[model samples]
Target chain A: MTTPAGTWNWLTDPAHWAGEDGIAHRLLEHVVLTAVCLAVACLIALPVALVLGHLGRGGALAVNISNVGRAVPTFAVLVLLLLTPVGRWGEGPTVVALVLFALPPLLTNAYVGVREVDRDTVRAARGTGMSGRQVLLQVELPLALPMILTGVRTAAVQLVATATIAALAGGGGLGRIITAGFNLASTPQVVAGAVLVAALALLVEGVFAAAERLGPPWTRGGAR
Target chain B: MPPDDCLARNEWICGAYLSTRRRILLDATLQHVRITVLAVLIGLLLAVPLALLARRLRPAAGPVLAGTTILYTIPSLAMFSLLLPLYGLSESLVVAGLALYSLTLLVRNILTGLRGVPEETRQAALGLGYGPLRLLLTVELPLALPAAMAGLRVATVSAVSLVTLGAVVGHGGLGNLIYAGMNTYFKAQVLTASVLCVVIAVAADLILLAVQRLITPWTRTERA
Candidate 1:
């Protein structure tokens, strides 16, 4: 098959855009799943990391422990979730899998961001009558904002790419397009689907990068 | 396969399955390691020259890094699908995609490592009559080794995780077993493959950590 022309035709077809399986619909599903997964990951990982970093205790240990999760394939996680009773919940399994997949970077960056803050600055904040909670929320969190944002960005891009696996488990996302292409042996449809996912991933990266650049200058340099 | 017999028996423990599929498990494990190592090495080879070029020419760094970052954001499934039209379910496509995915991490780390060398050290090397090539090979790259190692460790682990996606493209690995198990609703097979993937990733990382320590003993301090 002449995939270039075929892919173009598939992409341009109005028929591909009018139903639950349309590109726009799939794109929305992909984005919504990514957003939900990211939100849940942040809710779970951020507070724990921030507190550990603020307390100046167990930050390294926590980051290292969570980093272990990196080796476990998200596909495996999704499949295992499917095999368990959680499989009955459909979207719940995919969301849980993606959240587990997204945690390490968020936890690591937030912890590092807080731990890497200038000790003198923290001390000065305390000396100026900032309470412990105040020192954490005002001084340390502000200084750690860029890294925290960086973690979010990393997780977001990753979720966009990985959330495709949700389709494999009978959920909906851009991956459904590619898998559908595979089933029909339509190379062009597969290519078009891949292009869509790649484009979305790049867009997410670009947006996060712009956000990083717009961050407070003090936190920017220390983000990595 | 004995999976049918095991299912009939209704006692599908991890140990029971392991004893039955010893040969299949070993082969998949070996293939997984082989692909991961090849991909990481390819990524390192490609990254070094680009990283060096970026380090030498400041203007080129942004574009080079942005390009790789965009590439890195592509979903594993999408990337494999993108290559399918050309490679048609070959391992080469998966390996190429994984290598490409690795460039952003490797190039960034190597550039950071090279840039991290003290300016005075570079000046001193120049004053000592070291040629540009000599300065890089002798002074800068050696100093950059730690960061490069860190990059390699991350790339290797991530590649291990991503290589599982190759199973979707029909390249045999632990992932194929996971996929097969998922299709058949076999808990033991899924658990075994998933655990193996994690074990391989952690083992690869630890081995690289040891190698980094061996190469950079100066970075380690004596215990009291």
Candidate 2:
């Protein structure tokens, strides 16, 4: 039977599989970019959010600031950076924009997670002579694990999706394929690229969902 | 300075760009706003009924929720490509993709809000001879406004941001400028366009927040 459209043909072509602009190379670039951004964003966001939650202070300030940051679209940030000196440095602007894009969900979820830990449980931990660090690590962090994972999941999916926009900055990603398709006026290639991106995003989401479920048994809601 | 001196020199923050390109920017922004607002409104219209359906029929809750979640997982680039065939590179393609993206947030939040209505409150409303529709409209919906508003704010901000991606199709309001600017490495256009997208997203979020607060004054007292 004939293929429904050129989409399948474009995707299955052997020549598209080789060279620097190949699907594999672009996919790798997308993943590496996403991973690096997620790592940096997590490093920056998790500690501050966790610390603030541990100290039981500054929820309003943190959440409000992050919300404003979140409001700024990632696309604008990516494009703005592309015009800067740094944007010329290859992946710098993309990484920065993506990191910024990923920060809000990570920050908000981790903060809310740690803060939402039962107050009595925390007090008891302190009463039992646990240091503030101990309470944060042993009591709050464990309970907040699922929530933090949730933030990670959100950030991961968004990063995978938005990393495609990085192609507009001349950064590598599956999005490059779509943009290239547009340049060539090839609907099939564009559709094919979109399918790959959507698949990757969904895959990342599923991985994170599994990760969330893999949290301590308490995440499943049994333990007190 | 010549009217287009900044464009010639490629300055990042050119007053000349703004003055010379005001009409273009205004049109882009208006398009951006029109698409974003339309997407969110359509999203809410669809999401409310879906949320109500999920709430009304326990068996449907899983599928309805899962479907939106899957939709949300698709990357914006891919979402547009997948939708290209249906909408044929039209503005409606972008609007439809954004609306679909907003569905997960809207349906989930609205459902959560509706579910969160106190059982006693619902029961009391029922006992008062309030018809089902009246109960939903007057009591349940008002009570659900806070959660629903939270989703709306997020959906609106994201829509404002994502509409820029529509530039891939020559329909991405401010995104078109950003896209064109990047191709030419035109500093002023890219920076100006990007900043405008952020400003729009931030302003839209603030407006939604104000609307939420205005409509849900009870939440303020409850907090106090």
Candidate 3:
């Protein structure tokens, strides 16, 4: 199972990352899958959250259901889906699984954020002749943005990290490098892949932190 | 016999499907439950001391805790793959990876719980001539247990879910059922495993809730 001692040399070799069928292609696929999942999850969860918050109903059930969703392993979901007729053993199933993984946090945070807005603020909006939709759009959404963003930030990191598991299902990513290293008993290659994944996670976290800081003060330091 | 029954054959396909899927699911469920419990137990043993150390030494705490957080964010499959070079496809590798993943959440919650103790309570303890060790044991630790337990609850739920990924290494678990189903395209096995995982998560959460109530009666009162 041993490869050459410098097996990791391929990591930085321009040719290994540049052409078709290179690491770059896999990396691009990984990024696209992750992005699509996050986008889809947000689109679906946000409206549900808004409606739940607006009606002041189903909040507990929604949050509890999401907690259950989050508690189910992403890999398990992916594997289960792959067993279905609808799930091909590729990017499609992996992306769908990741979207399900991301949904709970986004929906929970959005719902809680909107619900926590001061009651007086809502009253004032209504008193000013604002329609229900207008009040939600003008007031609650702004107030909830930061909390919602925090959830997004958390989900983004989780999604990127979990996306690597797609490699097991033949959906390639940086994880392919790690798995290949394992098959070959290559420590340096293993180290290289793990380091790259860690670096990506930190970079995303930092970016999200900055984004959060750019928001209003009230939202920035709100209770977790 | 009815015409439909004759056409369909006298054998009960649904009964056969249910029994086979149920057997696989039950076996996998036991394995998943074992792995999750073992990993969480190990994680708690390691994390409690780390949490205490961090609380006592404020300056070095941030970097150490951050390192754990980064480890947590590392993709589980990638981490397992990385370790396979060193440990191979064994239960040790799976448990170790899961334990490391739980460290961040457990440590952060413990620290947060400790820090969240009211300043006046500590001051009162000091005035009563309690030393640092005694004050921590008698006052801070007791007050912080509820919050730390909340963190533990979250960690346990997470660990249970992630252990399913161990199926990739050929370990037996509910995930194994799902993965096997995927490999053979058995929809019944896939659905059975997934539904069982969800049920396990919900049941575990409810148990944790009861434990929290028992340990933190004051919290229960506050909620009520």
Ordered by lDDT, highest first, the candidates read 1, 2, 3
Q: Which candidate number would show the highest DockQ if scored against the true structure?
A: 1
Per-residue lDDT over B109-134 for candidate 3, one digit per residue giving the tens place of the 0 to 100 score: 88889889999999999999999989
**DockQ agreement of candidate 1 with the native complex:** 0.80
Residues A65-174 of candidate 1: C-alpha lDDT, one tens digit per residue? 66687788999999998888898986989999999989988998999999988999999999999999999999999989888888898889989999988877778999
lDDT of 1 by residue, B1-224 (tens): 45456545634365667887899999999989888988888999999999999998989999999888778888989988888877898888888888888877899999989989999999999999999999988999999999999999989998998888888777848988988888889888888898999999999999999999898888886432
Residue-wise C-alpha lDDT for candidate 2, range A98-137, written one tens digit per residue: 9988888888888889988999999999999999899999
Q: How accurate locally, in lDDT, is each candidate?
A: 0.88, 0.86, 0.78
User: Each predicted complex: what DockQ?
Assistant: 0.80, 0.68, 0.53
Q: What tens digits encode model 2's per-residue C-alpha lDDT throughout B1-224?
A: 55557678888889878998899999999999999989999999999999999999999999998898888888888899888877878999999999998888899999999999999999999999999999999999999998899889888887888888898889999999988988888888888888888888888888888888888898888999
lDDT of 1 at A110: 92
- Per model, how many backbone clashes are there? 0, 2, 0
